[model samples]
Target: MSTDTDRPLWLSGHMAPVPDEIDAVGLEVTGTLPDELTGRYFRNGPNPLPGNDSGHWFTGHGMIHGVRLNGGRAEWYRNRWVRTKKLADNSPFLRDDLTFDRAAVHANTHVIPHAGKILALVEVGFPYEMTPELETVGPCDFGGRLTTGMTAHPKQDPVTGELLFFGYGFMGPYLTYHRLSADGELVESRDIDVPGPTMMHDFAITENHVVWMDLPVVFDLELVNGSMPFRWDDGYGARLGVMPRHGDGPVRWFDIDPCYVFHVGNAHEDEQGRVVLDGARYSPAAFTAIWSETGGPVSEVPAADAKDPATAAASTGSARLHRWTLDPATGKATEEALDDRGVEFPTHDDTRTGHRHRYLYTEADGGAIVKYDLRTGSSTALELGADMAPGEAVFVPAEGARAEDEGWLMTIVSDRAGKGSELLVVNAADLSRTASVRLPRRVPAGFHGSWIPDA
Candidate 1:
């Protein structure tokens, strides 16, 4: 058996587990903080219980680490595990009848505050609502209207204040779309057609349409026991569906190349009425390698052995910034490479959702945060050094912001050099460090997060 020191790279160092809940007060800041950036920055990711093997990174229990900022000072920091029914009962996801429990969700993927509720979301179960204080409220069904599972990546329309999201299932009625009004009412739910069930992690939205991804990563019945039961099948094919937002219009599905997209930066309608979507694209080989390593036990390989060409190819799979333009009129789709650098966890001003926006901030595969200029097709990055690995860079708009990039980018940086984690504040315009609030412990690098401003 592999010892703790011999564990996988992801289960070691800064990615290791922190067993207890923590409350930190009055964190020290390194530079001048933004006055208007008063709110809570909550990030959710898999922080599995110590001594228990989660088997896969995606299967770990969700833990949220939040930092509260007020009056240009770091007020407090707290880390809490989302206490769910599964955690409370110590039950398995599958019952004796071999059926899956919809409520036995990890709730580890993403967290966002919407309609006066902070929801901790996974794609497979009902959203668990949490308080602004980071306490778990319980699984929410949008007042019992949302019967099926909810998507972690929901698009909030700035123009309508409406939330647009979808759920994909292993069973029939494979895809469904939902819309919630500004005041948190579940107003619409419709079944969406797809070729089959795909791992649709994220989608895009334009002013008049919702974009759907029918990609190759699919659920396999035989591998249901694995942490991530889905595998990439080249023959499943890939396509993009564009559906009208407010009508029963037929969804226009345009078959695209064989690839997978995990997250989208933004989507908008151009002058020619073509829907434009940008995100991180993963090729077939990259998808295969990433999923392959995720299974089996967590065992760390030596640095020299990890650098082998074959080993590098297997483990170095990274998503590059890619763009797709779908012309609804012509039924034709074209793709372009925005930047050659590997990036993921893309974010922009939430108010610019379903609209044309210029700047995109993403975490680079390396230890850096990249800022992409869509209009100019230029790129700038802030390197956090080779020792520290940062999580997603969330864009928080400034008060009365005048420009698109006029805001602050916040991210949690994990120090590999023995120092604890810290929340970084960067100037969104020039990709420069503005301030950093030091934390008392290491915060593991996890998936998605949100910046919820004080109401």
Candidate 2:
């Protein structure tokens, strides 16, 4: 019954920092649903949580417990794998939401408030698109609800307080275990595969081995959409798959295979399983940081274009690679020359005092946010950025009557004129600056965020 709170307040999740304000739902939806949509952030900096309405946009990473149970109000939650497009017949936007072909919200539900009730889940967006109206064809029509190309994430069942479900159903990097219950049901399901889902994407389980990343995928563009023109990485190979929390056969494979470009940026193990990978490297990029306990971080990737094929055919081009570390026992390498800063604090960790773990991963045009530092050193960054520079920050503390000792790090400032989304609030441990909540309404650039700080 540890009510966690040494002082909880460190937030930033964004979208709509430019183009006047992209318009996911702001600037008042005029003239038939604003085009090129953008704006994001469910809750913007400085402890925002009041009648909250930005609709929804939380790409990934969400589920922090800190010291508080549920009422401590810092439980945290965020999820998104959703894809509901229809740029006019590009497909995937079903439902009668208006009239679109290939539609699928996969999973969508947002909330934030803790130690009292509010740390829920459901946001299985898109994973290699598979729709028959979204599968599961054995249900009703009365209320009609059958969608499970599966995609869930939430952990906390050292012994079951519920909420212990990890899913995957768009195939690979395998992970599917359920026991949600708490009104959401899914009781007990199976099928857990972890043998290289071709560069797995999200993971962090520590009771005993789930540190992950056997990264190496050649191509599957994740169902093609905006960019990623194709090329999963031919002859691709990278293994470090460790699946043993209660694993069964072949769950402890490690073969960083003549690996070429490992991009796994987070993993922690220390009870003797000995695995630590925080990768970033491929075709002259530079930033290798591997501490492999002995198995392999893999390697063998070199071919094509050598460096910059016209910004690699411009997909918003960015390849600062080069960050290595592989010592499963002498497979060594190390490099770090990345700190363009747009987000800075300590890199990653202490999502709420997990202590300090140091995990800062950056990838955009769509989504990527990795920050960790529970209470030590994995070599921190505490800040990361990508996407029109930077436009999301938050940290507000001084409640009850607004006491003020400092708390507020809200940010969003895009000068594109589409309508810049603004909400500046700073000072969570000297982030510098303070106050400013201007918004004429116009948010669109969606993806990632959750901080209902008292609602």
Measured by lDDT, the strongest candidate is 1
Give me the displacement of residue 264 in model 1, in angstroms.
0.8
Whole-model lDDT for model 2 versus the true structure?
0.32
- Compute each candidate's TM-score over C-alphas: 0.94, 0.25
Off by over 4 Å in 1: 1-5, 94-100, 296-315, 417-419
Query: How badly does each model clash, as a count of residue pairs?
Result: 0, 94
Q: Lowest-lDDT window of 10 residues in candidate 2?
A: 287-296
lDDT of residue 20 for candidate 1 = 81
List model 1 lDDT by residue over 1-455, tens digit each.
76647886558777777888989898999998988888899999988887876878788889999999998899999999889877778667678996666677889989998889999999988888999999998988877798678899999999888998988888778999999898889999999878787889999999999999899888888777666778777578889989999888989999887778989999999999999999998766555556655553222432332445564465456788899999978999999989878788999999999999898999987699999999899889899887988889999888888999998999999977435899999999888889999998889879999999899
CA lDDT, every model vs. true structure: 0.85, 0.32
